[model samples]
Target chain A: MNGVHDLGGSDGHGPINPEPNEPVFHAEWEKRVFGMFLPVAACGYFNLDEFRHAIERMGAPSYLNTSYYEHWLHAFETLLVEKGALSAAELAARQQQIAEEAR
Target chain B: MASSAHTRPLSEVEIRVKALESLLVEKGLIDLAAVDALIDKYEHKVGPRNGARVVARAWVDPAYKARLLSHGTEAIAELGYTGMQGEDMVVVENTPEVHNVLVCTLCSCYPWPTLGLPPVWYKSAPYRSRVVIDPRGVLQEFGLQLPESTEVRVWDSTSEVRYMVLPERPPGTEHLSEDELAALVTRDAMIGVTKVSA
Candidate 1:
């Protein structure tokens, strides 16, 4: 099996020579997105009876348009706010504080 | 008991959910073990193996190939693997005559039903930007050296659609059963970076 970094590069030729010690944030993000979807899995979204029909109707265009994390984050954020688990103001405040700390 | 200094600090939302789940566990509303089992079930059973099965079936059966080309999801569903992630999937066939590759140019719009999850590289900005312009180069980086005469086509997956490659059956293995054929089908083969071989 080809490793994740084993795909794509310049030259249309040569073996994958990834930079050593380079952060794998991109790959890590993919796993994190999958982790975020664990709740959906637990909620029976992946069961044969529930999501099968929906999966059959999903289009390629929409799937490609959204990022892995964006999908989970969108669902989680929306549901949390709707269920009163989180408020818009609290989320905004947390985001602002994180941004401020970064600066 | 006081909270330990080494305890992890969770976000407010995380804390709330954790508390809720703990309450459920205490009240027997849900079993923690069951949650762990459910997660394990999907993570292991519902991933790239599905795509591998489809690709392998296409390799051995001409009828299945026709069905896959015309209706990939329905054909895949015939294998008892149907649902949302596989819903918008398109199966691009690679023949000795033509090679097909898949990519999500914008983000990683993977066929979760079939592929379970998109690999990190598939979602990375570097891949999205570089794959379309230099597909051959990208394949080469994957240690796949195709003949210059072979044409390479890249399908960009989107929010509504996902793609999987139906790799051509390699020669020298005529007697292999369906399961054996599936074993030869790797994730990279489905991605067009590598060919399935016995």
Candidate 2:
């Protein structure tokens, strides 16, 4: 899948800004998203290729705008729904519940 | 109850993740405890320190160096850094005349078992897009100015195979122990963005 994620030779993004003393994860949410990979993987819902493909399938703007772990989160949601492990409606309902709880 | 100092509203993505996690747990599709253990493994048990040990060992032992370059996955596993993204590895050696750097042009396919998770800059669009076309320029931006004569080799990692740079040992550290050598090896050095100093 040729997408913005395949950013090999294309240019004009900007100067690389390597942060000083960067942590492994920037946010707790990012950590949760990172941790989700192995266990979700253990369920055998989708393989690594499918996982990467799901991320690649993101629209160019969304893919580029989102953070690194957001990409992982996107893949998890996309694959789970696509694989019948979870339905989109259920995920949406859960999201609503969580958003309400947070508020 | 008032929100504590540490408490804040979760980001939209965070809310989404929390929602997904809880639902997955409810459906018995994933284990929360297993997720915590995985986080612990990445946060503490595994990291670039593992790769530093490998680089330090190779610096001290020529035999190990040969093994690492030729049979990367096995040599690395001998040191007990094997699994996941590091299952198939290629350890590229940097030398006086040649410098090696790695990037996953397609995606962030790094040797996680060795170097742990990649830094943010590694996954950013700028580094990924520019490094392959203008290696010398990118290296220069990293403050690693090579001689005009030094060849810059840029390795683009794939899903199956990953690359790590075996940075050349710096001079004037003959008395340094292997542990000391490991301490000098930084994540960026292993990533080939910078050189390990004595």
Candidate 3:
């Protein structure tokens, strides 16, 4: 599906501002999430292509607005639930628990 | 930084990923230790330095360079940089008349073993969307200005194959050893976003 992720040769994306000497992972949490990607995918929840497709399917506005790993996390959720490894209800409940804990 | 529109935490994706990770681990769909190993590999054992060594070896050894150009995956694996995104590596050289810049277009498909994870901009809509149509303009933004006559080939990685740019070595460096040459090879040069400086 030709989703929003295919932005090659388009416009309105400003500059490619590169940080001099970027760290492998920006933060500890980023590392954790980034780390989770390959293992979960390796479990047969979804192949690499489906995960990429899921990121592409993130809907243009949201796709452009979200961060890179956020896209990954979203795709992970979409596939996990779609593949029956987890359900939307369970995910929502987890989110609720997280929200309450944060308060 | 503040989270994106949808909040997951200060990082936006952290807590959600943790949530997903815990559930997956609980269900035996994934293992935390394996995930740690994956991160450790990319974070410590692999990176642009590995790619720099490859480029430097190609710079010094003609035979190795030929082998690299002909069979990138095998040549790269020769140096032990072989894994997920490194499976189908294609080495593109930047010559006086041509430059090769890579973009996934669809998603941030990158050669992880050699390049490590891509920078945020590499996975950004701006780089992805504009690089193909306006290669020169994008290169200019990256502070790389080429002659008007030069050819810019935008390798839109629409598949599993990944590309690495062999930047033209700078002049006046005959005394430098392979390690010294490797030190001069920047990640941006390998990505074709900038030139390797002294």
Candidate 4:
């Protein structure tokens, strides 16, 4: 897939600013997303390539704008729904519920 | 942050992740203990220190260096760093005449079992796209000005093979022990953006 994620040889993105004393994760949610990787993969929802492809399949706008763990979150959402592990509706409903609870 | 767009709030992402995790847990697809264990291992136990140790040993042992250069995965496994993204490894050595660097232009494919999760910049578009086309320029941006005599080699990691730079052992380190030598190896050096300084 010739998605925006294949950024090789492209230009005009800007300078690479390396962070000093960067943490392992930027946010708690990122930690949660990272933690979920092995468990989800262990249960056989998706393989590594499938997971990468899910990320690659993301829309260009969001793919470039979102954080790294957000990409992982997107992959889990995309693959789990596509793999029949959960329905899209169920994911939406759960997301809504989580949003409400947070408020 | 370089751009305002990069500063998007994490709340929405948090909500989405929470929802996904809750659903997975409810369906018995996720194990909380396993998740915790993985986090602890990555956050505390495993990291670039593993790769540093490997580089240090290779610097001291000629036979090990030969083996590491020839059979990266097996040699790295000898030091207990093998699995996941690191299953297929290639250790590129930096010498006086040649320098090497690693990147995954397509995605953030890194050696997790060895170097741990990559930094944010390594996964970002700027570093990915620019490095391949302008290796010397990007290396300059990293404050690593190479002489015209040195040839730069950039290895873009594919899904199958990951790369780690075996940085040249700096001068005046002959007295240092392997452990002490490992202490001098930084993550950036192993990634070949910068040299290991004594």
- Alpha-carbon local distance difference test for all models: 0.62, 0.90, 0.83, 0.90
lDDT of 4 by residue, B1-198 (tens): 122555443377777887888898899888889998888888888889999999999999999999999999999999999888898999999999999998999998888877998999999999999999999999998899999999999999988999999999999999999999999999999999999999
State the lDDT of candidate 1 residue by residue for B143-193, as single tens digits: 788888898999877667778888888898789898888888777788787
Measured on C-alpha atoms, candidate 4 has an lDDT of 0.90
lDDT of 2 by residue, B12-32 (tens): 888898999998889997888
**C-alpha TM-scores of all predictions:** 0.64, 0.97, 0.92, 0.94
Residues B119-155, model 3: lDDT tens digits: 8788887788888888898899888899999899988
**Deviation (Å) of B183 in candidate 3:** 0.6
Q: Write the per-residue lDDT of candidate 4 for residues A4-91, one digit (tens) a residue.
A: 9989999889999999878888877888899999889988878998999899988999999988888899899888898899999999
Total clashes in model 2, counting residue pairs 3 or more apart in sequence or in different chains = 0
Which 10 consecutive positions of candidate 2 chain A have the poorest summed lDDT? A94-103
- Give per-residue CA lDDT, model 2, range A43-62, as digits (tens): 99988899888989998999
**Candidates, DockQ:** 0.10, 0.74, 0.58, 0.58
Q: Which stretches of candidate 1 lie over 4 Å from their true place?
A: A1-85, A88-103, B1-38
Better of 1 and 3 by DockQ: 3
Comparing candidate 1 with candidate 4, which one achieves the higher TM-score? 4
* Per-residue error (Å), model 4, residue A102: 2.2
